[model samples]
Target: MNRNDTPNGSPAAPQASFSLRQLSDADWARFGAGEIAYLRPVTVNGVHAIAIHGADGAPIGAAPNAELAVAAILQHEMAPVLLH
Candidate 1:
C-alpha cells in the first residue's frame, strides 16, 4: 500500500493543504511556503548533492545524501518531497 492507503486497501482521508484561517492574498500565496520543501538532485563542484528549497522555490540548504537532506528538512518541521 502507498502512504495514503489504509490496511483494508481503502484510500485514507486527505489532509489539509492550506489553512482557511489565512488573512490575505499574500497568506494564500505562502500557504505552504515554510511547511513543504523540495529535494532536488544537483552537482555541486563535481560532487553529488541534494538541494533543499522551500515551496516557493527559495533555497534553504543542501546535503551530500538524501538521508541527511530529509533529516534536516524534518528538523525544521517541513515536509520533504523529491523532485523529478
Candidate 2:
C-alpha cells in the first residue's frame, strides 16, 4: 500500500539522488543551457513539512515545499514558477 503505487497495483521505481545542497554555485549558472526536456512533478506531505518531487518519469530531487521544488526543477526563481 505504498503511496507511489499505480492503478494496476505495481510499485514505482525509486528516483535518482540529486540533492540541492550538493549543487555548487557554478552549477546553477549552467542549468538548462543547451536543450529542453520535460519534467514531471509531484507534491507530497511529510509529518512536519510539505515537499515536491522531480518526477520527470524519474527523480531528480525533492524540495521542502512546492515553491522550492519548482524553483529547483526549473532552475529559476521567477514568478512563473510559483505554485499558484
Query: lDDT of each model, Cα atoms only?
Result: 0.90, 0.45
lDDT of 1 by residue, 23-67 (tens): 686765586898998999999889999999888787989999999
List all candidate RMSDs to the true structure: 8.2, 15.5
In terms of lDDT, the poorest run of 10 residues in model 1 is 22-31
Off by over 4 Å in 1: 1-29
Return the TM-score for candidate 2, rounded to 2 decimals: 0.28
Indicate which candidate wins on TM-score.
1
Candidate 2 lDDT score relative to the true structure: 0.45
Model 2, position 50, has a per-residue lDDT of 30
